[model samples]
Target: MIKIVLLGAGNVATHLYKGFKKANTVNVVQWYNRNLKSIETYKNEVKITDNVNNLIEADVYIIAVNDDAIPELSSTLPFENRLVVHTSGSARLYDIDQKLYRGVFYPLQTFSKAVDLDFTTVPICIETLRKKDFKLLETLGQSLGCVTYKVNPKQRPALHLAAVFVNNFTNQIYRIAHEITEKQGAEFDILKPLITETARKVQEVSPYIAQTGPAKRNDKKTIKRHLKLLDNPDQEAIYKLMTESIKKTHGH
Candidate 1:
């Protein structure tokens, strides 16, 4: 069994804890957070502690806290030469104290504590300083039924930047759409099917091939009308920027 000690209480950490609990070959031996109350409820299931010195022996120690906190937490860990990994997409693998085995176990997906997550669907990006430790991390990821990939430092950061464009930036556009619909007294739910179809289409074909709308067709009249409909300068700017991007992409 791969015994893991997860240290963090955020969305990624919470979801990982729940996923690990369900994996038969994986055991979450302990959970650590600076704020004990954040993980107090899981004390009965596994050892929970706020003190770093109280950490028990485990096969892997996962630091899932904020990117800024990673270096300090890694430095403060009571032991060294143990396998230590962080669940950050952008943070450097070397962020962990060099005294311990440094590695990254980034999950390429947005996480929310309230949403149900299926581990099998999430891709685990693994990187390690020591070649010997790679297999152990791969096995750890596989334990949760996740598809594992050996992503290098450059590729990992590039993937993370692309993720921000796809997930975070796309979600912001959705929020903008919601606001526009609300101002027009239209039910935002009416656009849900279109949103679902857009997502589904990308899975089957390249986004370039899936492109549609006035911008893609180079309908200058419709584009002008959209810009005129927007009262907020920020909204107008975003609409213009997106339209220009789409036009440029389609070679308009």
Candidate 2:
């Protein structure tokens, strides 16, 4: 069995625990968090401790803490020459103490504690200190039904930045649309089909090719009307900025 120790109790850590529970070949030997109460719920299910010194000997130690905390935590670990990884898309693998094996096991998906996600569709990006160690991570990813890829640490940052534009920025735009609809006393559900279709279209075609809107068409009159409709200066500015971006992208 692949014995593993998981550190942290945030969304990524919680989801990893749940996913590991379903894999028969994997064993969660222990869970560690700075605050005992944070992961107390799993006490009955597995060994839990708040002290890093109490960590058990395991095949791998997965640190799923914030990016900034990764360096300090990894440096403070009492063990050495053990397989240690962080679940951060942008964090440099070299940031982990040179005394230990460093790697990244970034799951490319947004995680929410209250939401259930199917691991099969998630892409698991792996990077390891030793080339041979990648096989173990690949096995772990496959066990969770994820599509795994060996990503270079240098390339990982660009991938993370692209994700921000597609996921984070797009979600914020959706929130703005929802607010606008609510202000007009309209049901946000009315735009659900359009949103769904937009997402679907991008899967079948390039986003550039799938683009369709007044901005894409360079309909200045319609653009002016949209800007006039939004009363908030912030919203109006965003509308104008996006329209200009679309026009620039399409070479209009």
Candidate 3:
């Protein structure tokens, strides 16, 4: 069995704790957070501690804290030469103390504590400094029924940047749409179907092929009308920028 000590109490950590619990081959031996109350509720299920010196021996220590906290936390771990991995999409693998076996087990998906996520659907990007450690990390990821990929340092950052465009930036645009709909006294729920269809289309075809709308067709009149409808300068600026980008992509 892969015995893991999970450290952190945020969204990623919470989800991973649940996923590991459901995996028969994995045992979350301990969970730690600087703020003990954040993870005190799980004390009945597993050992919980706030002191780094109190960490027990485990096969792997998974650090799921904020990107900035990774280096300091890894450095403070009482044990070394053990497998230590972080669940950050953008943080460097070497962010962990060199005294330990450093690696990354980034889940390439946005996680929210309230949202129900299926582990099988989340892709795990694995990277290890030592060649021998790769298989162990891969097995850990597989234990949760996640599809694992060997992503290098160079590629992982690029993948994270692309993810920001697709997930974070896309969500912001959705918020903008919601605001626009609210201004017109229209039901924002009416756009739900379009959102679903748009997401479904990209799975079956390239985004380029799935492209449509006035901007893609270079319909200047419609673009101008949209800009005029957006009274807020920030909203108008975003609309114009996205329209120009779409037009450029389609060679308009």
Candidate 4:
């Protein structure tokens, strides 16, 4: 079995622990966090600890904490030359302490502690210093049923930036739409089908080809009406900016 020591109790850590536990080929031997209470509930299943000195002997140590804490926390690892990896999309692999082996095991998916994720659907991106260590991580990734990709440091940052545009920025637009609907006393639920269809269309066709609406059609009247409906200055600015961008992209 590929034994793992999971560090942190945040969303990514929680989901990873559950996913790995379900995979017969991998064993999560221990879970550690500075705040013991955050990981205490997992004690029934795996050995849990707060002190770094109490960490168990394991094949791999996976850090799933905040990005800023990675360098400092990694420096404190009492052991050396082990396969230590961090679960961050944007952090440089060099950020880990040079005294020990370091790598990245970034899952290209948004994690939520309350949400159950299908490991098979998540894209596991990995990079390691040694070729042998890469095989070890690849084996672990495949065991979890993920589609693994050997992504390097230089390319990883670009992927992370694109993810922010597609996932984070798009979600913010959804929030803006929800607020607009709610302000007019309309049920946001009514837009559910439209939202789903919009997503589905982009999956089957290029986003440019799937694009529609007043901005795409260069309907000035509708654009002016939308701007007028948006009472908030910030909302109006965003709407106007996006409308202009769409027009420029489509040559409207």
Candidate 3 local lDDT, residue 131: 79
* Decoy 1 TM-score against native: 0.98
CA displacement after TM-score superposition, residue 25 of candidate 1 (Å):
0.4
List the candidate 2 regions with Cα displacement exceeding 4 Å: none
The full ranking of all candidates by lDDT, starting with the best, is 1, 3, 2, 4
lDDT of candidate 4? Answer: 0.92
lDDT (0 to 1) per candidate? 0.94, 0.93, 0.94, 0.92
State the lDDT of candidate 2 residue by residue for 9-58, as single tens digits.
99999999999999988999999999989889889999999889999999
Q: Residues 81-173, candidate 3, lDDT per residue (tens digit)?
A: 999999898999989999999999999999999999999999999999887788998998999899999989999999999999999999999
Q: Give model 4's clash tally.
A: 0
Sliding window of 10 residues with minimal summed lDDT for model 4: 107-116
Provide the lDDT at 25 for model 2: 89
lDDT of 4 by residue, 38-139 (tens): 988878999989999999899999999999999999999998988899999999999999988999999999888888899998999998989998999999
Q: How far in Å is the alpha carbon of 181 misplaced in model 4?
A: 0.7
Give the range of the ten consecutive residues with the poorest summed lDDT in model 1.
Answer: 129-138
Residue 134 of model 3, lDDT score: 89
List the lowest-lDDT window of 10 residues for candidate 3: 222-231
TM-score of every model versus the real structure: 0.98, 0.98, 0.98, 0.97
Better of 3 and 4 by TM-score: 3
Clashing pairs in 4: none
